[model samples]
Target: MSTELVSLDASKLAELIRTREVSPVEVVQAHLERIDAVDRRINAIVTVADDAIEAAKAAEAAVMAGRELGPLHGVPFTAKDAIDTAGVMTQRGSPIFKGRVPDTDATTVVRMKKAGGILLAKTNHPEFSFWIETDNLLSGRTLNPWNPDRTPGGSSGGESAAIAAGMSPIGLATDVAISIRGPAALTGVVGLKATHGRIPMTGIWPRVPRRFWHVGPIARSVRDVALAYSLLAGPDGADGFSTAPLQLDAGVGSSPGRPLRVGWLVDAFAPVDADVAATVRASAEALTSLGIAAEPVRIPVLEEINALELLWKLQVMETKPAFRKVTAGHEDKIFKHVQGVYDTPDTSIADFVDAEQKAEQLRDGFAAYFQRYDALICPVTTVPAHEHDAAEFDIDGQKVSSLHVMTATAPLSVTGLPGLSLRFGTSREGLPIGVQLVSPWMAESTILHLASLLEAVSPVRGLHPDMSRI
Candidate 1:
């Protein structure tokens, strides 16, 4: 198998398999080889299923027998450990539920398989999917494929790292705050956190019932993300709040003639690093190269965007009960990190109600903002991926806490807007920086259209870390 085959977009790969140019088994084997070669240094994959060979063989036989092929045909994809996979240990990065296995597949997983995506394995994540860095008592820490010392942002960090390292072209990941997009930025891959309720959140760990939680795809290209989105979207019936089938627009490469009305902003609730600012500026300049109307705009202070803190607090309120159920006889297995917040008091009903209303107001503010532009360009995180064990860092020469460090992404999460995070460039120290393009709620097509336009002018899909270990 050619190495170039591994880099083919999910669509192209599926077409090739459908045309019988490459068998499903061959494609799966190539990715499995890559994973075996590189996954150790990065530790991105948590568990590589032993029966992948049998599954791929079966897919190949179906194709050889002239059976109908799915959209993703022979493509291989991984899922974050937090996503429940039938018969696979869905350890949510915590030792408390170390050997926990699910008897049923998540709705998204079932859809992906039905669409012809082959599950390669499960990826790494932080304990309880809580931290920004991927680490836990079970799988250890997941390192950036580019620079092992730096982090691959979590809780989707492991998935990002694997794709960046060429272990998998696409992966299933979830987002509450910046888990999906943040890791995509840090690992130099394409990560999409679709508008809340756009994709069902069924069978995900640390499950939050609110609309703030979203599940989407992480891939090497925007088109791959779109393909995954199409396959994984729609109401699962179990998730009563999920939206109906989303109408996917033509892929980003569909139209290059029309210019995009791009809104550029850097000061998004927090400071942006010089490297990130340069990349965004250069990206906008590149958009202008493509006849795009790249306009500079100030981000409006959406009403009570800070209410994200409150929502996040409330989401974790269930953590105690959930953990208590798991750690019933063994509290010692629970990691002490972030215990202060969990052990603290719960939010009052009055405070929770006020926060929810404020969150709605923030969404309305973003609605007004999106009405003026096709999409808004912003930083995924204030800084590039930091050291693996970093607890805090200096921002603008002043020490800042980790929670405050990532305030830029919270507003979008609060508004439940669609955000597409693409790897833009590297920082001064050579760590990857992620820049995000956000659109109004349920406007994933617009978000992806702009991302594809940006990628065409300044291609980020081809950029990957040199994983010599592979």
Candidate 2:
């Protein structure tokens, strides 16, 4: 077997496995062996499924018996610790849920399993899925596969790291506020945070009061993201919040049959690093190459969305009891910055109502902006991947937490619009940097279509970190 098995795209692997050109067992074993060899260095995987091999064996039997295959048939994948998996320890990277096991798979997990995806393992996350860096009491920290000392981006950090290192072909991740996209940007992967509730958030940890929370996929390519999205999307009777399926096409770029008008938000309510700005600009430039018109537009209201200080406070107020038990004398051990959010008082009813109204207004404004442009181009983060333990950092002279610094990412979250994080290029320091492609609500296919074209023009898919480089 070649050591390069991990380098192949998930779609190619699934096709070969479905056609009997490669056995599912062989594919699973190759990834398992790769995990054994590389996971120690990155600490991305937590609990490897005990029956993974057996699961692969069974999947192989189905293939041999001429069973119809799903798009992702026989492909191996992993999920963030925040998503519940039946019979597996979903520790949530905290000592509180250490042995907690769900009797039923999460809505997304069950769908993926039914689609012929083998559950390989569970990846790491911040305690309670709270931070942009994946570290907690139970599982330690998940290091960036590119630069071990730098962060992999969280709470889907582990999912991003694992996929970047080739431990899994595709990863199931969550994105409350760039948790999926940020990690994808930092780790050189493709992550899509579809419109709110497009994928059910049932069984995910830290159930916040707001619908800003989203579950998405982090994968090696755009097609893999589409396949994962197709399986994970649609209405699950268990989740009533999931909106009726919009007429959204999430596949590759199709001829929109009209001239594409794109709104480029260069300064997305936050000061971006020089290299980060350049990376996004280059991507916008690439779009123009294909006859797409790019117009600079300002989203001033974007700054208001990142003032989530009050939002986090309300979340803490609601989940105080559950979090207290999880922290049990370990409050100091948790990320100090994260714990501080809870230290603030809860959002008063008046404040909550005011924010909701304001948020709706912001959504209306963006919808109007989208009326003029097919998509919005912006930065995913103010900077590229920071040091692994980066809690506080200086961005354009403002001292901010990793969470607040990602103001560029919050507008889409607050507006409940779909955003795709596309790896554009690396920083001068050789760290991965990506651009955010935003489309109107439920227009995931439109954003993805533009992303596919950008990806084809200036493909940054070449920079996967070989953790074994050392």
Model 1, residue pairs in steric clash: 185-434
User: What's the C-alpha lDDT at position 176 in model 1?
Assistant: 75
**lDDT by candidate, in order shown:** 0.79, 0.81
Q: All candidates' TM-scores? A: 0.93, 0.94
Best by TM-score: 2
lDDT per residue as tens, model 1, 1-470: 65777767677888899999998888889888888777878899998877788889999999999888899977888999999999888988887777888999999999999998888899998887777888877779899888888888878999999898888889999887888999998888899988778788888877643466788999988889988988888888888768566864322333566555678878654555678887887777777777777888875663235645865665666566766676677666666544644677787778778777877777777767866777788778878888867767777786766765457677777777788998777788877777788877677887787788777766444666777733
Error of 1 at 75 (Å): 1.5
Task: Tell me the deviation in Å of residue 135 in model 1.
Answer: 0.5
Residue 298 lDDT in model 1?
A: 77
Give me candidate 2's TM-score against the actual structure.
Answer: 0.94
User: lDDT tens string, model 2, 1-470?
Assistant: 64666788789899898779888899999999999999989999999999899999999999999999877788899999989999988987777567899888888888888888999999998887777788887889889988888898877999999998999999899887678999999988999998888888888877764477889889988888887887888777766678657456532346656787787876755567788888877888888878887767886666445435544544555666657666778766566545765676777888777776777777878877876777889888888899866667786687777665467776667667888998998888888888999887777877778887877876566667867752
Clashing residue pair totals per candidate (backbone < 3 A): 1, 1
